[model samples]
Target: MEEGIAIRAENICKSFGEGDSYIEVIKNASFTIHKGELIALIAPSGGGKTTLLMMIGCVEEPSSGKIWLGDKQVFADKWLTRETRKIRREKIGFIFQAHYLIPFLNIIDNLTLLPQANKTDDKTARAKARELLKYFDIAEKEKAMPSQLSGGQNQRVAIARALVNEPQIILADEPTAALDMQRSVDVVKMLKQIALEQKVAIIMVTHDERMLPYCDRIMKIEDKTTIFEEQQLQKNSTHSD
Candidate 1:
């Protein structure tokens, strides 16, 4: 069986500048994410939610602390390797508020781009892309352009693209922001299912409290510190549907 813990961060701090011009955004932020968990990261705007997520994704450097992805300690104040991009592409999947699909390419092509960049063979990448499209129930739209898809469908494609690499963790930044209320709820439920079924830990940054009832835990930034609140599973499941 695979280990359940996917991410572990200890006493992380992120600051910009130094001396008189210094500003601290995150102070001693620490948390853990386990596989099969869907966690919501909520806070007021500009409260370091995205900053913390980016640090975990290895896109941003932390001023201090330790970060472990799966069993690998990727950061201890400084990055362990110059191959941060490679580590990110391989271990972490990212979903953004915007679909950001390549408008010029067909759905399959857009989905295959990442794997291809990682040097996956054309045939294998195509096969994986088709499988993900089918898993998301968009297989028939494989050859269609991004402009031809509905908002929900396009977002699904974007998520499929994220998962095509078979990452251990997913970092979603306001993934449901552009959708209607019902669509947003549906998307969150799907994310919950994905986390459990795929056994991939997921952390989503959002301001939507409606999403809170679906998440297993809520991580919040309050007064420059990060804290986790475990959800009532009964209440969460009730609201999720």
Candidate 2:
């Protein structure tokens, strides 16, 4: 593991079935994501975009490959540890297309649940949750239910919740797909801000090319392999004219 490298994958492969029924999805994919970087993962439908993301997030195992989150090598042909769930809970944060905040829990409670479940004291967890709520500018909604907030507000809460654990890596899958253009842009900007401020690595799977400008780099899947490209961000040109 290299300094500041948050994720590293080498010769990773994934397939299903065997013999005549075998289907290969990804092959020989390799890449490294550094801390404080926001990367975009783009590919055609069913092109293993989410599959690769899931593998990195430890939700899906690679058929044969080596994966490292920070300095720990968690997989090589097989998962190195039986506690994949623990790894996810401790080292990774995940964001989905939908804001899956518990409907029964208020905004602050939704953020505190994971930390408390991970053994943090209730007072500490609530304090951290309050800090995140303030950071997201949703502090006034601490006691509001998910159903009471707008779509964008709930999504902000979702992003804040992902940060509550202070994980080294964040895996976001189409986080802004459900929002309108302006809202989507806002979400991407927020992600970029988080990566820089928290010094965390972020991999976002997106179908929208318009959001690429906000990312630090782009990772594309082609021919069952991975490609990396650097992004050219303008100085003070992130806004539309």
Candidate 3:
């Protein structure tokens, strides 16, 4: 991997089952995501978008080929380290379609939970969480529970929680799926700012083509392969299709 490249996947292939029962999802896919960029992952349903993201996030292992995150080669033929959980907690952040915040926990606690599990001191975790909340413009909601906040507020808190761990890569799966167009744009803009300001590479799995303008690059998984497109190229191609 080159300098400042947060993620690099080379000839990655994933499959399930064996023989006649087998199904191949991703094939010979190579891509790189650099720091300070927001990338949009666009694919039809069942196109392996979430599977690829989960593999990069260390939640799933590749069946073949190599994958790297920053300076570490996490997978070659198999996982480089036995402790994927540790790598995941330290190097990756995840956002889902649903906010997935614990209902009984207050916003602050929800944000602090993962960092604390990673052995960060309570003071440090809370301080980082507070800074992120302020950055996302939801500082006043820190004391509120998930049930008490609006959908957008909860999503903001989710973004804050993801950052509290200071992850190098963020994997967001359909983060704006539940929101209206305006709110979706709001979330994507916030993600763009976070990527540029924090220098963290963000891969957002989105079905909404309207949000592509906010991303620095677009990677579409098609025909069992990964096709990369510059934002300008995407404009000339995707919308016309």
For model 1 the local lDDT of residue 206 reads 82
Question: lDDT (CA) for every model shown?
Answer: 0.90, 0.92, 0.89
Model 2 residue 73 lDDT? 96
Write one digit per residue (lDDT tens) for candidate 3, span 81-110: 999999989999999998999999999999
Which candidate gets the maximum TM-score versus the true structure? Answer: 2
Q: Looking at model 3, how many pairs of residues clash?
A: 0
> How many Å off is the CA of 119 in candidate 2?
0.2
Q: Measured by C-alpha RMSD in angstroms, how accurate is candidate 1?
A: 2.1
Candidate 1, 161-201: lDDT as tens digits? 88999999999999999999998888888888888889999
- Candidate 2 runs further than 4 Å off: 235-241
Give residue 149's lDDT in candidate 2 (0 to 100).
99
Give per-residue lDDT, candidate 3, residue 138. 85
**Best of the candidates, lDDT:** 2
User: Which of candidates 1 and 3 is the stronger one according to lDDT?
Assistant: 1
